[model samples]
Target: MAQASAPSGLRFHSQIDYAGTMKISSHAVARMLGAWQAGPGPAHQRLSDRLRLLVLDGRLPLGAALPSERDLATALGTSRTTVGAAYRTLVEHGYLATRARARATVRLPHATPSERPAGTESATINLSFAAPPAPVEILHAAYAAALEQLPRYFERHGYDRYGTAELREAVADWYRRRGLPTAPDHIMITSGAQHALGLLARTLLSPRDKVLIDHPTYPHAIRTFAEARARLLPVAVGTCGWDTAQLQAAGRAAQLAYLIPDFHNPTGMCMSASVRRRLRLACPTIIDETMTDLALDGARPEPCAVHMPTAVSVGSVSKSIWGGLRTGWIRATPSLLERVEQARPATDLGTPVVEQLATAVLLNGRQTERPDALQHLRSHRDALTEALAEYLPDVHAPRPAGGVTLWGMFPEPVSSRLAAIAPDYGVTIAAGPRFGVGGAFERHIRLPYTLPSSQLTEAIRRLAQARLALTQGATGTHTPAPVA
Candidate 1:
């Protein structure tokens, strides 16, 4: 395998004619870094750190020509002097070489802590993760009630990784109430949906085994599969629902298919009963039901797993109740259950006993519903959709039957550009590209209606202002209009 390339300061490409021969540019090098922005640091330090990560991460392979100083400056929106300083810093750090040809080339130094890419520190409104705030009082009460039951298990081994049999039974019963016949023997409690996915990846996938995913799917699942060395094949999801033809094609080519059959992330599209049946016939599936219970505007529930007997159903209280619960489970066949049980310890030993017990308490009716939270989320969703219709009229804001996000499509391919600018107005939003594989869906943005109505209104006003400013070629600071 070829070594990875080095990182550079800029996000765009720059072509340079080298030694009166072949042309080289930073595009390939920056592409290797996955187009990450330099994290928060002093301007030059951030630039240098990003460059080093690209090199160390094998994103910029050896002998690749760095962008010219002028091109680097333009790409980063900084002065050539600043780009020069950053290049000098990297050179001193042994990450690049100033060759006789006068074009800088990438080189790798010994791996060190500085080699890691700096964490994302962008201040944009982070609608990227479709998370809602926890109901703190309700969660606290649930925990208290759980502690009261804790002493009963004190004499026994307090830590059970496969989850307490009680919680497993509760999960099974939870599914049964949802119209699926699940049993405790078929459930494996996990830390969260992501953890459960990771366990499944490790257990079921081998290097380069094809895993089918939807075009605009949950991104973290893609990462999990990629880390497990599985090749991802994305099938397009239609405006109404999953594309059955593409799904069947992918299933024929892949070993597994990961789906969000209930209120999909970003799109908010749910799979119909017919399509779910087709998917079941196609392959063994992993159906994520995190947003299944989060219906808004009196939307009816449509459970996909109910139509697919062989499906592995993944659910969590994160979307329905509180993200702080840190509890989720996989409902599958008893055979798959045994396999997951054997693989669970290698990831986390098991989900936390305390959190599981608290979740069980909530499941068992110890806590009351917070009407205010649901009402707030619903109002926010409505306000956001109305705002989008009024301001971004050209954009397609599909009113999802339920769920907390509004997926809007712009007339232009500048969703990433908008994401880069949203932070200035104190509102964070996710670009459509972040939700899909490769660089598709650049015209989209996912806005969550999980914030309080007042904040949601203010956020929409800021977004309108940002959209106007972007169209007019303004960057950096702008006075935002007051939320009406």
Candidate 2:
């Protein structure tokens, strides 16, 4: 990792090269540390816990230089001694690295068996990842069929940056069936939708370039764009949903925009066709269609590009089929795809060959969408909402028309605190703040319906107990692990 110079007047001396490393500003860190003093503890302890959470949850990137202790103390309205003690505590825990006169940089502690949360060995219901379970027969058959066809490509080197021809056309046909005309030439296979987003960010965004995003969007997308060094322009998606005027205004100044109009993650609110057609943007938009096939209330949505032809669509069967398959593709102009192919080698040579063949089989056979699976998902979604109502009555969970998760709003801002204690109760959740920037969504959490109804109900039951413990001022000593 590259080192960074101390800001003017900080007084740091180092022989190490200090160029190209990212340094988060004091004010920015202050904003992300919203209400760090709200939790019970000594001021230094509270600040340290909150800062550790920020690092653990990935708000602070590892190797990024922190503000000088004095500057941070000033920004945080605390004593410099308090700041110094917190930094020292972090260093002792291996969450930060510091040298004489140099600013502390974020790092993760080395893992030990004792570090595992209690009850982790037990069966824990995980609501952190929103993905469907595999259709056993369908998956097995697809792979079996793929093996029968695999020998045809044996004569050549298996290092095609562009994925196999079979899968590309199958993906193209997927869009064509949904009213968007696509050719295989316009498609480029990726490991997954997240990979596609990273590739696009690398190829297109320059440092400090503005990228527009939905507030309370996908967590990994937030991380990807931030890692690319892009300045995010967030447009809120509130109860009434997206504001086209606000999006267009932001888009006019942004270099790129990313939207998840089709069953938007966490919220699971699908953008109306009217909004889709009227929502024109000044910048190139990447539309995530990962949840398009999980519609429980209506027919599947048409591709967003049907209305906005210039939009780039990224889709994966992770939600529709199984996450383990790890197959996804980008739908864009051939010229744009050519650029993606050129940039692809820097990240990964290609997605796995057998997986591509299996995915191609699944797509061609239309096995990704099964009525039984959709029905099961609908049952799980209903069960999760019912459980929330029965146990956590004050938490309002909206029934999504599509998608695998719901955004649950708590009566208070206890999201991060709740997540820290949730694992001990045998349920792990993706805290709401993980999906947003600047410490927003503190009163919300993303609840996935991926588990079976019985397990979902049990998870909620445990969550209710956790909340009760939290209300009684029982703060568990645990840091949340990363979420998908």
Candidate 3:
């Protein structure tokens, strides 16, 4: 029998084994490279540019094998030559590495001195993350109060998988304040909301478990479920908000569901009372309430669990208070809490005593509901939308009623391209694909208004310039965005 050769005309030095490497199918790559030909450029350049953006934005994981040129060409409905040229460009730029007979693998370029952001100017503004700054006075007072109570925990061993009793009750009261009855046994503390989600994912999901999630939902949640090897079933959340029929239809076959109905991430649209009452799912659901206290409109929406009692609730003060406070909790039935506590040792011992004490003080005092903080958020939100109108009139950025972000829709699919180049204009943005699986939402970008009004205005001004450059097909110089 003759040995199989590399895909058509391609050759390799040696036969490479791709046993454990993540290989993306040709069809999937084509789907991810959505509308690549629509941008201004040669076919090959356009393809390479989109591929590079996918890699840079982390849609394409590093070291993942790409489909063969011939295979991808067939899937993309392009010639093999075009695909080959694009691959070559990617290889030359260090976005990919090709072995003799092996498929090309994804890799980012090694940054040189010139590629690094220089001074504070490059750190001028960042809209990539949707988190608020610390409330200095409030945070200090809470910690001071916590320090006073720290002596109470000195007698016992510092291991508490179930968290402190006082904090758990405080977390329970947080729900009770919102019209949902909860108990201390219903709460278990974790480092933060993200940590709580990870614990739940580990405890609830097995390999290949079906998880229903909102399309273009929280990016980290997408990553968490994907990392767990769970099959994701996405229901589209449109400008009009979630479709109840579509959500229920998708949930029927799912084992677990994750939702951000309380001022949903990126889009910041809250699930209305009517929808919450009507919405029911076959699977157990996890509802994230990180932004519940940041309601800018009239009143805070009642908890989703108010309608669906079996739904688990995860919340943190990271959004409402400060990102520095790494404290959060899980609100579920006592039986579920028992399972989580049993699995807690594998991850870590427990949440920090001091932070938990401080969070208890903050929650009991209702500091997260500060009038001044909410007012500032409202003002900054207004400023961000105003900036978008004045600077990038063509882009549609709807003002969210609560969360710190503005979901911007471009006239074209320029989000990833804009994100790649935005830092050169002294701004950083979260491209839309980051929030979604595959390469969906190419026409959208999520901009956070957590910065000061002046910074928000300036960032949008710079962002508009970046958008102009991208639209004009200018492959200008690049500068890496400031790392948080």
Winner by TM-score: 3
lDDT of 1 by residue, 1-484 (tens): 1111111111222333545322345443434334344344577765675566445423345666788888777755678887888899989877778976467887765544321112223233445456788778778888898788888888986667568887898888777776788778888889887788888888889877878887777867877886776767777766767767767766777788898877788777777767776665466788888887766655445567777678888888887787767899888888887887787777678777778888888776623234565677777788877777776778888887666677888888766556645666566666675566545566788887777665566667677777776788753311121110
Ranking by lDDT: 2, 3, 1
TM-score of candidate 2 to 2 decimals? 0.89
> lDDT tens string, model 3, 395-444?
88776879778889988887777888877777778778777765778889
Ranking by TM-score: 3, 2, 1
Expressed as tens digits, the lDDT of each residue in 243-272 for candidate 2 is 788778788878899999888998998888
lDDT of 2: 0.84
Better of 2 and 3 by lDDT: 2
Lowest lDDT block of 10, candidate 2: 2-11
Better of 2 and 3 by TM-score: 3
lDDT of 2 at 482: 59
Please provide TM-scores, in order, for all candidate models, with all chains considered together: 0.74, 0.89, 0.91
Candidate 1 — which residues are off by over 4 angstroms?
Answer: 1-126, 297-302, 366-373, 474-484
The Cα error of candidate 1 at residue 241, in Å, is 1.3
| RMSD of each predicted structure | 10.3, 5.6, 6.8
